[model samples]
Target: MWRIFSFPLSQIHPAVLALQLHLPNKHMVRFREDDIMSNIVDRERDKRTMLTAFFLKNKADETKPKYLYKDFPKHYTWNGATRTWTPRILKPQRGRIVSANPAEGERYYLRLLLSNVKGPTSFEDLCTVNGVTYATFRKAALEIGLIENDDSLSQCLTEASLFQFPNALRRLFATIMIFCEPGDIRKLWNEHFNAMSEDHQLYCQSVERVQNMVLTDIRAILQSMGKNLTDFDLPNLTEEDLQYGIHREVQEEYGIVVEAEDLCAKDELNSDQKLIFDEIMTHVDNDRPGVFFIDGPGGTGKTFLYKALLAQVRSRGLIALATASSGAAANNMPGGRTAHSRFKIPICVDNNSVCNIKKQSGTAELIRSSKLIIWDEASMAKRQAIEAVDRTLQDIIGVTLPFGGKIMVMGGDFRQVLPVIKRGTRAQIVDSSLRMSPLWSITKKMRLTINMRALNDPWYCGFLLRVGDGTEQSIEGSYIRIPDNMTIPCTDRQNSITELINAVFPSLQNNVHSSDYIISRAILTTKNDSVDEINDKMIDMFQGEEKVYYSFDEAEDDHHNYYPTEFLNSLTVSGLPPHKLRLKIGCPIILLRNIDPSHGLCNGTRLICRGFQRNVIDAEIVVGQHTGKRVFLPRIPLCLSEDDMFPFKLKRKQFPIRLSFAMTINKAQGQTIPNVGVFLPDSVFSHGQLYVALSRGISRKNTKVLVHPAKDFKQPGVYTSNVVYREVLLDG
Candidate 1:
């Protein structure tokens, strides 16, 4: 008879101990041992006997039992002296509990099981649960000799245990069962102990420290819910640990510190401005969409507040853009662009043409990347035009829902001029108008208060605001006394108006640094005239002032300097003299196209001409950039076709000679002129038109408006006809 002996025991036959342990379970006797050798032999044999007994027990328990003991092999010998069992080691099977006690490496095996059950798990998750680094785990596996240093089995195991913990651990248990037999666990323990580095050994000493603080915290929480540590799966533990760890890591990594107040204060703002700013900031903070309408009479610092908000946005690293309905309005504030230009919206000519082609092109890509857009002079933009921009933005940014990408700020007085379009019915007009849209509807309901206007001025601000609302006694005002120091006379309407033009033109030309002294006029000389008559008049005007104007034919063929010479010659043929002209490199010019009213020529319809060069017989007009399309205009006087007509019906040359006069209100958008001359002709004085024209010239110090009689000037809405009037008093 053989007996197995464990440490410090050598007195018993292991086979006798095993037989004794099994004899009782077979009958009525129970096996017990005081000696270590007997205990070792007894336990091993007991396992074998139990295995056989379990088969027999199942046969007895089942109603229809299969034959089992007939196929069972004979039991092996047990030696007490060596504590050995003589049966082949069986493969460890997955999901089978090898040990129930926590003391004999049960916790370590449990962790391995959990790791295998979870699939493709993160090291962070494992570290979070085990309170150990990947390096430490790898070193331990190597020292234990469970895996070779070159095998990478530990790393593979760690990688496979990412998110699914219980699953990964089960798989890991199955894997260990394949490689590790029941007899090999002792060898594994010795290898694991040998693999520990000095630091890891020291860390192992503090394992209880980590387990007590971190693991204990988690265990306690789970235990309160009646869960055993063994039953607490790794995934739940990982999630709990990871959330806490991530917060701690982020705080450490970013060094984030909360402040008591915002860095920039709003102490300088007025009540209304402060309210608007606060509202905008609140929306930004909450990531909500907000639309604000700052409606104020002229001179109310609406632009100033807009700029301040832009600065605030920039300081916060947010992208922002500003636009206006007209170039003049865009120029009202610094760094502003026309809405059409900013959004790359096409100027509508043919009703069927694409209204916003740029949005479909690369320009949309650019606009989508911007975080904020501010549109001024919104009143002048047609509903269709605004809609086109909105649609384009929505398409480019993939904003299926409303207000998707960035903040949009639109500023304009609705009383100003409406957009100009050619052929649309009343219903179409109503559908496409900006003021009638859902956005505007909501805005009107919100009733965003005005920030600045004439109310700020001591003399005219209050009066204009009241009159603009149509609540004042009358829209007219008495003629105020003109200062004696004013060079231009303000007595008679036309004289004062002409003097204002003469004074302002030189200043404008100088401010723009234009070297060419070119002044083209399109005067309405007759109510009814044939195309021939208009042509004859144009030719007469061209030939009338040869000394002042040199024809293109008269220009010398000096290619090196011909551009300036040819430009002068063209102007000279048009009644301007070369000697009087001062053409500068960067001067701004306006080019108007002669429209056939009978064909669809209209007041609001014109080409925006930029960039200029002089050729041999023509002046090359840069309609866009060098990369854009360009055209050449002959120096010779050209005739208008009989088909040419104005939208408003004027005689030939009614809006004649494609005059490039001082910049018009539309062209002057988004520009700041040191000196401006505003002509409020009686014909151009409707409530809407007045606002459009007045607002074009923004600076009070250098802006002047010439009107018929001061009493003839009428207030139609909240903004003054005198838009350039200063809010602050100027001491001369």
Candidate 2:
């Protein structure tokens, strides 16, 4: 953020007019780091530190110019005789490279050795001692007395096995083998083989077959990492095992279980949905290409249509890809994944950007072979992201048409949350939306007017349309007055949130372990701060002992420098969980990052804490297609986006989850909570935030509001702002 106030340059820094002449050939002088500043001969009377005999530093003055210079730091001199400040440059201390996470393992220790030992030109030079080279950085560090042991390697694997899947574990093992040389590879394998082969054993039901399958998988993993099993003291793979099919994409697709209920979902589609299903199925049956879009408001059965389409394609033993803009929405469908993960779309995209998918890659093959591609919540994605997918698909399928002339069906509600642009203007946000994409003009558009979720509450459905359309009656300018019956009388902050908790999660103490009871409700707020406040309050009020897990936070580039551990712990950033996570048994928690979404771990995925251990949280999925799935979540390092306010990258090592008694309005998007309580101590900030929050429930009776506006309330009831950018919004 640039300063709003500015002053003349002359006043900000010293003038360069009084710089003295220097003779570099005459002599050389040097001083200790402390002596230069502590010695009186090199110091000034006004507490200015002398960078050198010929240079001055205003280190005590924050208003003075400060530059992060690697060498020849610019310094200024206060010329007492001329009553002016002169500038000079002098060499200063240098810093070493570091990473964000302290527990990054062997490479972390190598970085430490490099920081201190110095002067090593090559990898061999760093590990050489007495004219002999060590095998690894771990050995060198041990010899140099930098550390005691490489025990963290075993500990890391043990912790990971408790949470990660067999495939993720194999990849991690391969990474460890490449980077770190463990003391006993055989011992490591013998101990963790159960975890690495758990699934194979379950399926094969024979010790020999399971071991062979596991070895084959590991062999394949090693080849991908440019290594072989022979490199380590591990068991060798058979000649047959050395050869694995290149049909990984085909295997994963066929593994998608198609239930009879999903197959029957097609028969239940409404008249409007049937038109879209038939139109898209016609192209699929004929082996033709087309792009189609299903536009609708919230609860118009977009997910229902997606299930019917997926079922139609998959039941016939064909491939169908289900993707959504957000992980929460993606979890709602069968075999759904976020578009970014599925397409390998770059996080930071531009007009010239294409997906990271290569023609020979498994993801590329998946896209090429899939019969139908269904992208839900398309409006929330950036145009560039969609464009990248289109370009990559065209290139992969060897076609000159949009999405490589593939059968594409996208769906979204334009009145809901659009693409989130950091510090963006109204025009920029609208321009970044999918509606602004060139493909939007060519795609066949379909609309669903029936609000299936609100079918029983037609009055509530009409009210939501008004909120979405910005045609609702306003009490104070753009601020809308919520119906009194739908709002809790705001007496105080504590009381209001307490009332909301009762309304949303009633009998919390009695029904803590009941997944069905807690899974159906949520409380929404506009800000992260408010979400934290309400969650903390809810956890404290609940009938259980809270367990706190603290994160190890670090700054990667050291641009922000080594912030104290205590200070780093106090930070809370968007899209990341808090540094100190407070969780309890049976309390609702939401995944902050997308970890194994196919197993139902993703952002906005709600889970119930079954148990808590030192390194992992034992939890059960309470929502979405993978309900009742008990899984373990290990402490993983999470970093902030590039647009973070910090000077450098901030990484925190903790479970990628947050308490979900209350969640932000943005996180609450693409979700339907049976009972919702909107807490509004602060008004909605961005466009469509108010409309999205109010329309999260099936009926007005189940949805309640708790508004204690920061501004003084003068006359009658609670009122909050309804921000609707009508220009980009479509009416039903």
Candidate 3:
């Protein structure tokens, strides 16, 4: 059924299929076939004879093929259209082909035949057929002109086995090769090159560039091995070299550029404030030493402009220091220190120390070191105090003038209270003498006219702003509001106050306002029948918190004098004395005899707590630092004038020694809280005390006050009636 081609067959071994064909006119072709059938029996026999001879010669080497030829192809097909002929090129399709002494040309033909075969083959198959090592087969292919002599074979092999290696090993190999022979191996790329599109080619180029850069860096690293390098000595390279080197390389390949810039610029202020701040900055830039005063009523934005100026100075790399009269006020501004604490000025005690010039040198050194100094609450700072500070600066920095510390900014309103001092007439005279100096006269003064009060109620803002200003008209109506439920018996006033507090500040019952609530007990001066009983009750009331006491006699300093301890001892022998007891700052007591208020002696008036004093004998109580006076209260009431009503009746302690008391007027100087309940009793109406108390209400929405129901108590004067108040309310 089939037409068999008549051709001379070559007999080759099953394992070594090597046959070379000789065409007409020395045009040679090679193929290896072990299963081809020949129609001529004689030719088949000749094939068998050639294969046996080849096998016999190679039988000694076990690693090589046992025989070179066993079966060979005897048939062939010719294609006239292609002008070429096809032959079976693999074993089992033709008779084994024999090659007793294969020439280089014959070997090339055999390789071409092997490469053209349809089935898969291994390195061992090639070795068995060619009778050589795997490496030998590769070299022989190059030597016989079957494949290129360059590293194309190696590159192809690497690419084929790339996925077979571990990731780390592959990376290491790539690094080594990229660095060692970058240019020499560029042309020997494998299937990855043939498969890439135009876009991928660009990507590959970027990858190549990064690889080259890495190679260069590796060379540098090798040269610098074991050498020490500091951060300052390192090269200042661009971020492109630090991050995404491949991305940077890709961008370079695509001709893309990115630019980065630094951010450093000043911010603009509000329109009106801008003009004022700009002028200040101009003066500071010129290095002109002048006192710039920013005086405003409580609500005006003087502090905002001050901060803007500080910012401008900092932007120019200049230093500015801010200081205030007290620690509380110092904390209001950034980087602020208390003026007295910063200068180490001793607190004013007596007339001698108030005008003293011996402590000036140390203060001057601090002033010389600073460029700009801002003193807040300047109104509270006394003229004598300012003079002492100025003298100190003059002694150290040698300026001898008000602007001796360079640029100075003082901010305050003079409507507030003046400084407290002993020997009032002498202190005033000394203070006046310092203000007369010519150097103190020429500081530039700026007044803030615009009121930017943060209160929603206009009346409240107006009232606070006009407190110490004499020109402003007083609002006449009583601001105190006594709730309907507060009309309880006089004995229940404490319970009513407690109930009112709980209702007004419901959140304060928890932790929110815990620190703000403080209870103070009235001190008992007379050792009467009720004294021991009241002290026991007071001790029970102040059980958990700190209790402070003021003793009457030196002997009372012993534990036996304390009423709480006495009561507790009577009840139980092992009972402990109250542990949280501390002494109050100011406590009032009558002296055994009459003493003058002006002669540095405590008479009947209130004794303020200046602070404590120490001496060798013992630490004695210092009553008022302002007047340089001291006194201790006694358990027995001291009889004053015989004509005085109830001569034996104990006087109320002048200074409340139990706890600190900030009056309604003192509390009104600063911020307004969310809710405030004021107790305005009839006793608080004397000498504009009502006015001060009413102004302390601060806000209509947040403030509530309690007052007496009696119409007679509303009279004006020191005790003014409701007549002028009603008229003022109508006008408003």
Candidate 4:
């Protein structure tokens, strides 16, 4: 380099480097004067992009295409003219926290240890405790309390055995043994043997025969997971009781029972619902790749129609995946799961993205095998998530067709919250929704007009439509008038939060234990600060002794510990529980994460706190299909996503829950609250927020608005900002 500098310092052209310019060695970049390589790559990419965009935009020209798609580079490539590596691919960085499932065996233990341990060099370091090292990763994880014992496994069974049949319990036991990585299999079987073998015990005369039947059933379940009973610590099946195993679909279609009521739902569908039900059913019946979107507002029987369609397909022994964008909506239907959990959609997505589901994995098989997929609240999901599914299906099924030629039935109202873009504008939010997706043009559109909740009051229904459509006359910059019946004036003695809570949860002290009273009522606000203010005061007024749970927070990969404990604890984020979560024994709370959607533990799920322990929280599902079901929640290690606007990844280990007395408007989508109180400390900021908050209630009598203007408390009457991106409501 010195010899070249001495020979011709100013004469040599900057773009003289060969392919070695990409090497990160001691040599400086050759093209220092200008980014000639980048410019070359950009020009090439623009040309290729324009050629394709031109063809797509002007297909009517009927001219022969000059360039094929394969001519473009897939990723960074070598440019012959510039003699530098060209960046051709716009690779999308998918922000997803990769957590190991219990079924992954050693890797799961390692992940568990990693969540707690720091600065480990090798597997031996993780397995080592003091001077001695454990034989297995499981022993190591248990040694340091990184992974708890079989309590979760036992509770899972205890919860399942309440309504599940004996055979199902045994199957669950087998699944737990195989996938859950339970430390003591023999102990679990011994504890639940009676329930697992109850059916066989009734018929079999001898005790040995019942035990043998139970073990035989478990053996069959174990075989389905590609494991033998001998792999576990359970007793060997009796030769006489040993039998064949039945195959199960990856998505568990066989696990669902076709009840008489579910079957009768098809016949009871309303005329509007029947039309959608018939169209989707026909496509499934004929084995066609049909894409349909059922457009409807809240309380318009969308969930009712979804259930009917799911039952129809499941009744025919076909696999129907019922998924929703929000967990609240998912919990309303039978065999429902959140769309993200079902599809493995990336947490942070971009234009170029794909589903994280592996081709050989069970999830892939489920997608390929499923005859129907009903994605509820589709309007709320990001266009990239929808596109990711399309790309994944096309790749995995080896069929270039949309969604791998599967029938995808998505239903939602565009009037509600659209796809959330972090700090996104109106245009950004609208552009992120399915309305802008390429698939929207080809997808069949259906509408549901009859408002089942407000059908009696046509005026109220019309008013809601006007609010959502942004058609209501504005008082001041999108501020709309609140119906006098629904407005609650804030007074000096009674604060807005207290008044709002009182309206929603009447006789709170008396009805603390009543799930019906709590589940049907909630206070909706436009911001988290307002929600927190309401929750703090409400919890203080609540009867039971306050239970304060503090989160363990730290910045991951910060070896120097630049972020201190105090700073970490103070960081509050959306969709994450606060640093200090205070609760009472009977106070209703909402899940901040999807712990187990199948068991009614999901984000936005309402629960009544039954008991509290140092390591776990005992709660009861107070809403949706699993009402009154008890569940255990452990302190899980959760990290804020890459999109949380933090330089370093923030990890917080805490129970995924928050006080549900008040929640933001976005979280209230798809829920039917009988009594809702909207608190507006300021005007609603985002699109459809005002409409969603106001429309959550069943009627105006139960719905109340507590508007506390920041500067002007003396406004003529209660009036808050109603943000509606009317362009999104357009059919186009």
Candidate 5:
């Protein structure tokens, strides 16, 4: 009879000690464990029986490895003395290399090594051994491939059951590994660790754990990222650490340097400008807080006076904060930024809103140090935005005085563009202006009558003032006739479009590719539809390979009802690109998003397309201080929240650029171009639309009008209607 014995104890389950199997007449039978162990093995057949039983007990009976008793040596052979079988050895597989390039390998290796970096000395030594600067180390770590393509530290730690470094250092460096802004991180580390004394560095390296070194870097990084550092329970850094960070932030933000020679000489100020300048300087000399609103039409040197004031205060070593309502206007001012960006004002402001500023914030400290605050284009800002800054100022300076004891100088032409209130009535629009604010009661009013752009063409400038004031005679139903010299008439729609295009884009055959030439002149339209029509027409005229781009449009969420794709493609709105946007290599495009203001990718910035990729467009800036600088713009998702326009939340992914051949009048505001052609295919829809459009050209000779005769006009002439809210002109 055959009996079972254990083959090897290590590979056997503990359940085998209590189990036994029996077979009789080739039929399997069950027996007790004592019966199987007590019987000693005597033959090869019995050894095979023991191995088969062991394998069957561990897994399923039918799926067990089948082998004849004589064929057991082909797989596993049992040792007569040791009672154990030796398994066949297998070959090890080679791993595929993720990075074969030496540079890429170094980048991966550096990231892995830095992931365990603990102290300043360790980090410094790592950089030394690598023969790379701290900036280079940061750049290597920040390379997208290093983190995404390589094995993750977390995955490795999980597999190894312990991190490569101490737990505290591991966790801290893990966060640094994921930091997106490498330049900001590098700057933070340089500012903190590099400036530390040798004794303090030693103490952090030897005495305290890695958390202390990591905490210091994180605090500086958070502060630079515009986060309130007070929220974190961090250890107190040195006074220099606190002060240098604030100073660096402020310097980077408001640090405008105007060459002393670039400033307009004192003798260059006209009589009207001199009067306003003298009054402003008197308030500055007295060191008394005052709120003054300087009103002037477009091209009347409001920006010139603003720059002069900035230069004067900055030359005197006094803090003067210059900000504008629009990015274009802000770019023209030395050391200027948008008021909302500078003051941390909420984007969507209401009556109860206040600036998002804390008493101990860097912004508050900058304001406290400032002796004057100059907000240009004040009339264009919503009253709520202005009041928000006022409330925050009062809270920070600990004074109820206007603007918190800081002299406030505001300037803008109300006749140009007032506060934009979407779908608002005339009353709603007029009430949103800065003049309607509660603080307007204590303001001093100053007016400028001279138009610097039209100094040699006073008659044309006077006509513009009349057009802005609505004093110009209405030809029929709020329409006015365009002068022959300032307009080119056409007998047909086709002829009219051709004539207008030729007049604005003269010599297009020679300069279509020139960025300077393209931006020197642009056609203005009152509506976005007309702008698109003109842009498509102009792109057809440009000589280059045109690349067409289509956006991915969809509902924000797909829950219950599914909207048709065809219906989404049919929708159009302002402040958004069309479904199909076409561009040539040399075509100029305006940015729609403020992606990187430091790199001049702000809204309203004009760039010339240099090249195109699948997801991004390479372009060179042709406007503002960053002119000739090349930048890459990627396609981003944008959503419009106008419930009045769409039934559901709609998102479109497209490049943040639009053709610059023509733009809406609302977009043309705060811009001064060399030449402008107002294409009045449709009349102005709201107040100040006509003023903003007609005032863009630098001079009357460079400006022209091509209008389609107003509907129902009995008079035989082109007509233009001016929009003005007289209530905004009222002074408290």
Candidate 6:
């Protein structure tokens, strides 16, 4: 047998290792190649040739099967015969346009040629010599009218379809696609473009050219929808365009437009309401802007007065921008928007922060022309948010007065959720409230005495007042015992929850899938865990086949993946959809994101699950002005950076919906329901929460509260906490 040598070993023989001949020392010895050849055959080169030939034969054999070298999941299978990878059957992508333009056709042809020939991208790459093919592309572009004399690159882009170019122009291509596609860009511009004046557009164009400016007047308008100057070409949008966009947005997002018959609603106002309405209207009539606050608990017909005021101003053909601090409240008022959305208030605000409104902008025009601005649920907003608006308004109107001397009607029960200072103490929370703002001193106080919710039941009204005022007889400092009539009598906590559910959602077995019946009431809770528990129980109770949807959760920051998939799956947090979302057909669900406001698919919008498909589901709006309207919902990427519960920022791409059978008290704050069931497994940790939860019911008869008793007290009676900050309630 011959030994095969590899690399450096080929130069050496075993005879060298056996040599003991000494050249420099007594023990050294050496042998010649002939000595080794006498005992061995030189077959190393032959063996090497055989191995090389074997590998070459395998490489050149085209008939042999090939398999995917990369490992894939079970769902993806590799076929050796076809040398292809295939996935399990899936529905084709929807709303995707394939044939966009001549450029796309050319690109497709190029791709086909490359596939067939397995050639390089360019002819130069295939050729042994360097040459140019720029003329070829230019000629093709000219033939298709994509290039013409005196045409700028921007102009050419506007004239051509997005798909005409390859993927190198990612941002520009995406923007163009948005303009042509059935999405936000077209919807926003088309609805508001004509409303902009030519001069305003010119002004916006000039401002947009200022590269060094911190924020331009034109960008202010476009930035509301995450749009920027780069999204459009020359002759950019004017201030008028931006204003119109805001107007259309307010129209679509709030669904609060006042109709001809809406003016007649003023005649139905109560005496207290009529007085406040007249007092506010007096300021509008005098052309003098005034700040007024309507102090009233929930169910006091506050929203009724909001409509009356909107009707009065709009009936005269004057603009009355109605807004609320919360989405649920915004929906209640016609043409209402959240204060932040309408004012373009910064998400993070400080004392020096002004709203993103510009003096030369369309929003400024709307504000200047508006006779009144109604901000409902004002108390829930941070004091800085209110001041930010005031500063921006004063700057826009060029006035040294409050809110730029604009007639502002702010309404909310201060007794409800105050400014939420995340993890702040009582002092911090009270100080952050709108009542603590400097504008509060100038605000004319208007109180709504009569509780329209408990109009027929004085007892319920009194109970709510005591709860709000902190006069409720507490077992300790803040803990109080629930009155008998307000609670469902049950010994066990589980039984109490069952009774509470039965009270709010009666005939569930029969009307489980009824959108109207299901949304008629909801179980309100203080904690997410309790809300989830109740939702699970209600979903299980619903009569239908359940379809489970899991979210793709990951960290937003580029850090270590310390948080595992299982950990994220088990999290229960506010303003986040669950990891496991189980829904049944016809079950009521609330939208977690604002998909389309014009179609009434805004946040806080209630919809019923209709059908499910790949990456999407069909839902019909069961609440708000667009009720009965069916819309398709797709899994969208969602991020929650504002929430501080998670260590690192969390991101989840999933359907933006959650079961509506039960929701948190914070979510139910600005909403009013005919029948409300308050399930307090744990006492409320924030101020105004208990009051907000209890006040959601239309009347005491329709509302029922069940609180977990104090530890070691396993009785039917309920114990609750009243978190009121007296400092915030004090008159400035």
Best by lDDT: 2
Q: Which regions in candidate 1 have their CA more than 4 angstroms from the true location?
A: 1-268, 331-335, 349-362, 403-405, 422-433, 444-457, 470-681, 692-732
lDDT score for candidate 1 against the true structure: 0.38
TM-score of 4: 0.69
Superposed by TM-score, candidate 2 places the C-alpha of residue 571 at a distance from the truth, in angstroms, of 0.8
Summing lDDT over every window of 10 consecutive residues in candidate 5, give the lowest-scoring window.
93-102
Give the range where candidate 2 is weakest over 10 consecutive residues by summed lDDT: 12-21
lDDT of 2 by residue, 57-135 (tens): 3233435544322122234434656544455555434322323223434444444444434334344666775577887
lDDT of 5 by residue, 64-180 (tens): 464332233455544557655444354422211121112333333333333222221222344443365543443433331222322233222232222222322222222233322
Candidate 2 segments whose C-alpha is farther than 4 A from its true place: 1-190, 194-210, 215-236, 239-246, 557-562, 710-715
lDDT of 5 at 1: 46
Per-residue lDDT tens digits of candidate 6, residues 221-240?
33444466666543443333
lDDT assessment of candidate 6: 0.65
Q: Residue-wise lDDT of candidate 1 within 535-607, one digit each (tens)?
A: 2332333212221112212222433432322123223222121222222223222333321111111122223
Q: CA lDDT of 166 in candidate 2?
A: 79
Query: How do the candidates rank by TM-score, highest first?
Result: 2, 4, 5, 6, 1, 3
Best by TM-score: 2
Which 10 successive residues of model 3 have the least lDDT summed?
A: 256-265
User: What lDDT score belongs to each candidate, Candidate 1 first?
Assistant: 0.38, 0.74, 0.37, 0.73, 0.66, 0.65
| lDDT (Cα) of model 3 | 0.37
Q: Which stretches of candidate 3 lie over 4 Å from their true place?
A: 1-275, 349-364, 422-440, 471-496, 499-504, 512-674, 677-698, 706-732
lDDT for 407 (candidate 5): 91
RMSD of model 4 against the true structure: 20.1
Off by over 4 Å in 6: 1-257, 557-560, 597-599, 643-647, 712-717, 730-732
TM for every model, in the order presented, reads 0.39, 0.74, 0.39, 0.69, 0.67, 0.67
